[model samples]
Structure formats: C-alpha cells, structure tokens
Target chain A: MRTDLCDLLGIDHPIVGFSPSEHVVAAISRAGGLGVLGAVRFNDAAELDTVLTWLDRETGGRPYGVDVVMPSTVPTEGLPEDLNAMVPSGHHEFVERTLLRLGVPPLSAAQDRPGVLGWLHSVARAHVEVALNHPIRLIANALGPPPPDVISQAHDRGVLVAALAGRADHARSHVRSGVDIVVAQGYEAGGHTGEIAGMVLVPEVVDAVHVPVLAAGGIGSGRQIAAALALGARGVWMGSLWLGTTEYQSGHALREALLRATSSDTVRSRIYSGKPARLLRNRWTDAWSAQGAPAVLPMPLQNLLVSAAHDRLMASGDPTVVPMPVGQIVGRMNEVRPVAAVLSDLVTEADETLGRLHKLL
Target chain B: MRTDLCDLLGIDHPIVGFSPSEHVVAAISRAGGLGVLGAVRFNDAAELDTVLTWLDRETGGRPYGVDVVMPSTVPTEGLPEDLNAMVPSGHHEFVERTLLRLGVPPLSAAQDRPGVLGWLHSVARAHVEVALNHPIRLIANALGPPPPDVISQAHDRGVLVAALAGRADHARSHVRSGVDIVVAQGYEAGGHTGEIAGMVLVPEVVDAVHVPVLAAGGIGSGRQIAAALALGARGVWMGSLWLGTTEYQSGHALREALLRATSSDTVRSRIYSGKPARLLRNRWTDAWSAQGAPAVLPMPLQNLLVSAAHDRLMASGDPTVVPMPVGQIVGRMNEVRPVAAVLSDLVTEADETLGRLHKLL
Candidate 1:
C-alpha cells in the first residue's frame, strides 16, 4: 500500500488524518499513518506550545504535522473594539430567535468561549513559528496558499508545506507559490470548500499541478482510498472519519447525532464559517438558510459572529441546534472505534479490495 | 478489465456512451461499447423508429440502448393547446431580451423548430413503445425512476431497464421500483443532475442498490473510468464526452466553443431545463443568472420557453448565445475526433493505467 507519498512523508502508509485532538494525532502516527493536528483553534501561542510539547512526548518521536488556517488574504484595517461588534444585528437576532424557538436555554456567562485565532494572518504566523520550533514533519495551510515567506521558512527548516485547494487553478497557484503538496478538497468535505466534488477535482488538480496531490472529502473506507489513488492522487487526507474515533473530543450528543445521520443529513452552508463548508444540518443551519434569513457575512467576521453563539450552543447541550463539521462519509461512521482499530481496518479493507481487482485482471 | 456489467449488458467493455446522434451511437457500439441513443429529442414515433432502424443496420446486430426523459411524475391534466402556451410571459421575455442583447437574429419562419417531448409522460411513453419494437438491449430513463408498469413492460420484452439518480436514496428508490441499472449522475454531469458529485454519489449508490451501478459526471478519460470502478461502480456512463465527436451533429461553432472552454466555464443553473443542469457558461446562462433575472418556470414550461429561442440562436450561427449541456470534463476536450478513435484511446489508456497499478502491487 506504500506509494510515493509514504516515501515523501516518511510514513508506512499514505493515509493522513487531520483533527484537533492530541490523542488522535499520537494514535494515528503510532498506527503507521500521519496525524496532522489542526492548530487553528489555539488563540494563545503559549497554549499551542504546551500542546505541541505534549504531542511530542505522546508520539514517541514518530512523524506528525501541524495545520493552521492561514488564508491568503484578510481584512487588514477597521478592527472592531470587540469581536461581537463585527456581527450584524440581524444575524445575532436570527441566532437568538431560532434558539428560543427551538426551546434551548441560554448559556451561563462564565462558560468558556471557543478559541478564534487562525483566521487572522498574524495569529496564524505565530502558530507557524511555534510549529516550526517543534520536530514537526509538515506544516499545512487549511484555507489557501501560505504566504511566500512562510513556505520558504518551512523549506528552510526541511519541513514540507501543504495547502488545501478546491479548484484546479488554486492548485496551480499553490504550486506556483512553492507548495510541496496540494490537498484537493471536494465540496463534500467538512471544512471550507468550493463547488467541485472530489472525484472530478482530484484528477484535475493532479493534472494541473506538478506537486503530489492528496484527495480529501467523503473519504472513509479503503474503497474510497483506492479510488483516490486511481484518480492520480498520491495519498488521502481525511478529517471527518476521525471524528467518530474514540480518541476524538466529541460529546456524547454529537457522537450520537453523527452515528444516526445519513449522507443526506449534511449541507454546504455559509452559516458556520463565512465560506461554504459541509456541516451536519441541524436547527442552526436550517434557521440560517430558511426564508427571511439574513445573508451570511464573510471570513473573520463570520467566524467572530458565530464564536460566542457556538460556545453557547455547545454549552446548552441541545443536540438539535449544535453545529458539527463533518462530511458525507459520516454515513459510514456508525461506530466509535479506537484509532488503531480504524487504521487496521482501512489497511485490511484496501488490501481485500485490491485483491478483488487483481482477480479481474 | 471485464466486470459483471459487461456480462449483464453483453458488451465487450463496460463503457456506455449516451448521445442523440445515430452516427455516434453506432460508432461507439462498433468500437466495443454500449451506445445509448438519446431519444428525448424525438417527438414523433415515426422519426424515432427510422433512426433506430438505421442504428440497427449500422451496428450490424450489436446491442444498443435508448434513453428517454420520461420523468416518473408529470402534470397530465393541464395539457396546453401549443407548447408555447404553457410558458409564462416573463420567461419568454427574458429569453428574447437576452438573445437580442447578444445580437442574435431570429430564425426564418420556415426553419424547423427543435422537438420538445419526453418532458411529458404521454410523449415519453410513445418513445418507449417505439423503442421496444426495435431490438433494444436496454431502456434507460434519463430522469427519475420509470413507473413500475414500465419496468415490467421492459422486463416482459427481455429488455433491461435503467434510471439515472443523483442521490443515494434515489438509487434505493429506483432499485425498489425494479430498475436493472442505476446511473449515478453527479452535479458535474451534463443535463439534469443532483447536488452530489460523482465520486461520493457512485459509492453511495453502489452501497444502496443491488443492481449494477454506472458512474457519470465529469468523466472524460481512462483515469476517471478507473476511479469509478475503484469507487465500486461496475462501469462508466458518459454523455458530455460525445458532444465534440466528429459523428455528432453539433455545429462547427459549437464544437469550437466546447474545445476552447475550461472546466470553470460551466455553471449549474435552472434556466434552460427547469432542473439544475451543468452547462457551458454562455451569454444565455449568464443572462438568466444575472442580477434582476426573472425566476425560471417549471419543467415542461421552461423547456417550452427556450425551445424556439434555442432554435433561433443555433440558426444565428452565434455560439456565444447558444446553451450547450456539458460536464466539467469539457476542459480536457480540446480537439474533435472520430467516435471510434475516442473509444479506442479510452481502452488503451485504461489498460495502461491498470498495468501501472499492477506493478505497484
């Protein structure tokens, strides 16, 4: 099952898991696959330093990576006094009214808010600097191409740089900007995405760029992994599949909703983060897309607008209104297994699928 | 390279080409594939009968299929005196205004108008009856599942029945209704399509149904065909790839436009067919989706509203205003080739791709 990607990343397998959990990162790397920790949630550099130190000790010196949300552009001026001020009044009213209609209680003032930093370029650079200090094998930009200096910095440190692209032209631009790898994310992916699907986007990106491509979105099983390889991608970058792992930090209510949901239960809406991200459709998404709903704002403003509301919704523990970023592959994630078990199953299934095809030849 | 689909369809390869041209249909079948004639353009049973007879003679006893746009449900009681009467005034004005702005001239009164059928159940049934009279190996419905009686009728005549679906649940419904094959058409596909991409939709449909599954949408090369098989699809069903074939009846201007257009040049809009179809972005599509554009009408009405205008635009010999249904794969189609040459290239490329993967094993 080893491909050029395994040789490049110095991993036994080509499957790369992206998650925000340190436990998942260590487990996936120890299981012979690459685990990329999403560092977008850390607002404090000291806190990120602490997390990376813990991850370093937990991985037992195995290779792992860090992913930051460094979008190519951000609003530079007109900084608001408070993040909440950036949100429109209509959007706030819509969220509050919908929660009220859904019979959800307000959160206590003492509840901790969700972290928000990666959307800003300055904060993301801090994260990149912290990540580079550690023995990180790779650094990935979640939103777009990393700045030229950041790519050069990673290169200078002998670390590979990867960027997520939803379109072929984006992949070409990333390659032109000196990215070592391109993750072709389809519309069915959990996070920010473009309109193209993985099946079409993978080959297009692979053809458009000279760099190795990693196929993402709606990839859960060995058959899907094989499909990605067949489409000319060197590896598969998975995020949603790891959400159902026992090591993830998902609450019981969220896990239950994910297990019970079908592929059709997800929708690509701008309600969660300014961009169109595939999320589990719940009362919140429905309310935002419903008639008379206000248009969603873009980028940092949208992230800031929903940060407090997301914290409150999570605190409320009302499953119907909680937001969960997941892909259509959630349909196949019917159980919570250990990370090791998930990796073993993927390898075995892929082997059997390849064996079946060999019989055809 | 042979799979269960080849045995079921009794073809040399699992590739199936769908087009409205008899010349292309016969050429594909002769080149060791199943050629499905798009019968939606045939309003008169006599015309379809003549075409089928010619195809039969051309293929020299090889198996072929017929495709009709017979949506399972339709408004039967509200039959209009003429097709134009069913179209709303606003939609007609929008089309006329857009064409005038593009400097397109009206067609002569004596010019023959394009046939508008299949959107109506009555006309589609006539198409099915005429098709069954010939030695059609398969009968496929382009929209929705064929009615239970229609399936039984095809079964009684020993002709297999297939239907196109964009969602997993829709595939299950088609299987429940006795479809022998399910064509999973993704959002990147030409003609009427659902929101899901072929990569995600194929595996989902393959898991949901017991019948053979054909992957469609954005498939133009052998690598894509291999990807479909890896995703658990039995074969590949193609539509847009045949549009630029020398055997097709497309005008030189239209073929030139298709050759020059990129994947990003297509848009999914509900202007031409009432259903969201991925078409080459042109002056007509841009006008319809432009700001202050009127809302598109329902299925048959939308088709009727654009029918005469479509004829005039094609007659005008101005490709910019003409609406052409194509997939994102159009970006790869930079040249026109004979249908036989295209099919031969696909087989050779697929063989090479499979051999390369075997070496990896």
Candidate 2:
C-alpha cells in the first residue's frame, strides 16, 4: 500500500473522513486517515475547542482537520448579535405553522435560542487557525473556494488548500485561483451539490483543471474506488462511506436504514438545504416537494431554520418530517466496520479492477 | 460561409448535415454546410448510386459526406446466404406469431427477400470504395470508432475522421487509438448514448481527450451552442434541430409535435437501435417499456424488424409506436424555415452567448 498519504497527513490514504463525532475523528487519524470533525452545528467556539483538544489527545499525536459551511455568497448580514435577537417573528411563525399542520408540538420558550451563524465564519476560522498552530496537514473549504486569506494562511502554515466544484467550470476557477486540489463532486455526493451525476463529473473536472483532482461523491467501496481511478481521478474523497463506520456517531435508526438500503434508493432534493442536495428520499423530503408550499429559503436562512427542526425531531423520533444530509452512497454503507478496514478493502478492490482493465488491453 | 468541412474533405464547416433526403443534403451543402446523406436503409448499390449522382448534380460542385452504421461490435456476420438461409425458421415463426397477434398482414412470397443488411462491412467497404471514387470530404462511423482500415483509408484520401463517445472513457480511448476528433455526445442527444447527461458529459470528455471535442446532444439554439463552447468543446454537432426545417423531410404530424416540445420532453430509451438512444417519447416507445417484451436485438437485427413496422404504421398515419431519434433540442425546432436561416441564427446565438458569459467575469 502507498501510505504516503498517511505520512503526509500524519494518518492513512489521504482519505479525509468527515464526521460529527470526536471519536471518529480520533479513531480515523489513529488508523492513518485524518478525520475531519464537522463543526456546523457546534453551538459555541469554546465548546468546539474542547472537542478539538479531545481529538488531539485521543489520536495520540496524529493529525486531524475541521470543517465549516461558509457560503460563497451571503444574502445579508441581518443576523442578530445577541442569540435572543436572532429569532425571527415570520420565520419562527412559519415553523410554528408547519409543526401545527403536522400536529406536532412547537418549540417551547426555553428552546427558542437561535443557531450559530452569527459567529460561524469567525469560529471556523479560529478553529482552523488553532489547528494550524499544531501539526495539521490540510485545511479544506466545504462549500466553495475558501476566502483568499484562509488559502494564503494555510499555505503559510504549509497546509494544503482544497475546494469542491459541482461542475467543471468551478473546478477550473479553483485551479485559476491557485488552489492545490479540486474536489470534483457529483450529485451522488452528500450535502450541497449541483445536478450532474458522479460517473461523468469526475473525469470532466480532472480534464478541466491542471491541479490534482480528488473524485468525491458516492464512493463507498473498492469497486467504486477502482472506477474513480479508471476515470482518471488520482485519489478519492469519501464522506458518506465514512458515516456508517463504527467510529461514526450516526444514530441507530439512520445507520440501520443506511445499512439496509440498496443502490436504487436516494434522491436529490432541496428540503435539507436551500440548494439541491442528494439524500435518501423519505417522507420529510417528499412532503416539502409536494403541492403548494413555500419554497425553502436559500442557504444560511434555510440552514438556520432546518437545524431547529432537526434538534426537536431527534428527541421526538418523528422522522416523517425530519431529514439528514446523506448521499446516494448510503445504499453502499452496508456494514459497520473500522475505518481502516474500509480503506484497506477499497484500495484492494481498486488493484483488482486495474488488473482486469489491463488484461482487456 | 464555409459549407464543406475544409482541409479534411475540401469542404466548408466540418458540419455534416444528416438527413434522410438527398435533396435536403444537397441544399444544405450548397448553402455552406456539409450535407451528409444517411444510408441507413439503402436498398443496394444501384439505388445508392442513383441518389449519390442526383446529390452530386443538385449541390453544384459543393462537397458532401456519407454516414454508415459500422458499429464496433456486432453479434453475427449480418444477413445469411439468402432469404432461405438468413433468418432461422424459429425466428420467422416467432415474427409470424407476433404479426398475427397484432393483426398485421402476411408477407408476400416474392417479397420474402432478406432484410437490408446491405450495409454489412463487406458491403460498406464496397460503398466506401465507390465513395473514394467520388468527392466526399469526410467519413463518419455513426455507431462507434470506425475500423482502422476505414480510418487509414480515409486519411490516405485526406478525408477527416470523426467518432462519437457518450462517456469520457470512450472519448479517451478514441484519442489514444489515433482518432482526429471526438464527438462528445450526451444522453439528450439523438441516437445511441449512455445515461450520463450532456452538461456533465461534454466537459468530462473535453478534459479527458486531447483531440478537439465537438459537443453534441440537445444543442439547437445560439445559447446552447455558446454553452457548449464555454464548457470547453471546440465546436458543436447537431442532428435533431435540422429535422423540422422546411428543407428537411419530416411529415406534418412529426414536425408539429417537435415544434411544440420543451427541453424536458425527450427520453433516453433503447427502443430504436437496441442501444440506449434518446428520442421523443410516445405511445409506441412507452408500450414496449411497460412489460416483458423481448429485448430489441442489436444493430441490423433491430433495424430489420422496426423499419418494416414503422413504414406500415406511418403509411396508415398511426406511427404512435415509431421512434424518430430526436434530441432534447427538438424544443427549438419550433419553426419551418430555410436551412440558411437556421445556420446563420446558430452562429449569431453563439456569439451573443459568449458576450454574456464575459460580462459575468
């Protein structure tokens, strides 16, 4: 195995495992791939620091990274300074109307506090800056190209810079901006992405940009990994494939559902984020897609409202109207194995595919 | 305006207009584009010669091209020794059973000749030999990569070669095999294509192959032509957009329906060539998709069965089951104008689109 990615990242396969769990981040890095703890829903900068510190200690000096959602474009900075002031009358009223229509209880006065957007960029930057103060190997912008200062600062710290492009144009633009690697994401990817399917998008981005291309989106197995390489992607950036591993913090319901699903499942919808994103199509996503309903607000505002519903539904177990951002790759997340085992199998499968492809020539 | 594909075939634009009518082909080439007469169901050499001669005179020294379906993979050597030796008795009985069930007419004894697999390699090679004796500027293999001898001979004659690929892997393979140009076709394209869509597939193919990429699929207007160029394609390949112009040979029913379509009205189904091909979906195509209908046979075999049925249905004005391979671009085939009007509008549209794209920067 070429474990240079491990040596470079201070972990394994250059695979950046994305998760919401401190345990996963530590375990993945210990196994040789750096685990990126998602900080989207973290309520405060101080709380996030403890988790980062915990990850550092838990991994025994192995490197790790942090992820954040900084919109390439923000609608307005009308966000409130005080947490209390962030609550909107019409927005919450819309949420209340939806809950009433669904015959569910509204959030109580005690649970009326807003989300973490007021300081999301600053907090994420603080985390990145703090991680760089250590031996971290990379800093990636999840939503788009990272602001220029972040790119320069990462380079100054000898960390690599990466951005995701849903189409070839975006990938070329990233290369033009001097970004080191472009993640050519397909619609099969989790989170926010445009409508282009993965099998076609990878090679397009690889061809469009001079920078090394890492194929992301629905990559979960060795066979898929092989397919990506054959399509000319140098390496793979897996997200959903990591969500079902033992190290992940996925709830039993979603995890089990993921493990049982086949490739036929999953659909791209905009219910979770304001933008179109691929997820397993369930009643919640379906309900919003049907009939006369207000279209979801574009990002930032939509992200603000949906997080509150997710918080409530997790406790209520009312999955009918609550959803998660997962990818079509969830269908292939059939078992809970160690992160290292998954990585090992993926590389092995790729080897076999290359061997078979060679014989045909 | 350059009418023939220059340098390769001593013509104007490398644009080859594919139409069922020799008259239309002649007019298109005379008007400054290479008019390619489709030889799909050409009965024999004598009949083809008549059409070619007529085309030569009508175009007034303007060069033209010929398109033949010489697929890379074919199951058998095509037609058997004779009518008796060709189709199996069992297969013949099955056809009779189907025709009786559908309440169709029995075959006349004199007309029991084998179907037109007259374009089999040996025959097409003969046709090419005849064509080499003529003034064709380019030679295209519609189904896949043209044979090595076909490529070499065309090159020897100083004729250009073009092959179509719906995927990046295929496109790269074409370039590696010494192809001069690649037609990057998307699923929205008429004729055979994979499930990968155009907006995604075009750029991928462009990136994967070094040869100049011609974007094909649902492009019909100036805006779409500009979009293809923006996506990194060198030029554009059109098929369906020309089918409804007054110079083309479409009947009233087909032309009216095409004029009324939108971008969303087409479907990719293997009903036509036993290969995944996009066309305007209708009752005939839908009927076959519904159940356990025997899969369509590849190439000449499927062509053998469907063509006869289509002629009969079309004669009776009930072609609800006939599929005319059309692109999503059929939406723009909203008028019946002269071929010159269509060609000039496209160039103008592309120029305007480039202007708008620059404004975004």
* lDDT string, candidate 2, A1-361, tens digits: 2323445455546466777788877777787667777776666766777787787788888777776666566443453444334546665666666666765565678766566462256556666666566556666677777777778888898887778888787788777776787787876677777755554466567668877777787676554554455345656677777778887766665666677654335666766656777776665565567675556765555666666665564444454544666776665566799877877776666555444333221
Q: State what share of the real interface contacts each candidate retains.
A: 0.48, 0.01
* lDDT tens digits, residue span A170-220, model 1: 999989999999999987888788887787789899999999999999888
Local distance difference test, each candidate: 0.85, 0.65
Highest-DockQ candidate: 1
Ten-residue segment with the worst summed lDDT in candidate 2 chain B? B1-10
lDDT by residue for model 2 (B114-226), tens: 45554366566666666666667766667667778778888898776778887787888777766777888776677777645555566667768877777787666655555
Which of the CAPRI classes, incorrect, acceptable, medium or high, describes model 2?
incorrect
lDDT of 2 at A170: 79
Model 2 misplaced regions, further than 4 Å:
A1-11, A81-94, A100-120, A319-321, B1-361
Residue-level lDDT of model 1, residues B1-361, one tens digit each, is: 7788998888998899999899999999998899999987887889999999999899998899999887777753245357567667776777778888989887776887664765777878889889999999999998878888889989999999999999898899988999999999987898888877776788889999899999999888887887788788888999999998999988866887898887778888887778888888998788887898888887777777777777777777776766788888888888899998998888776666665555545
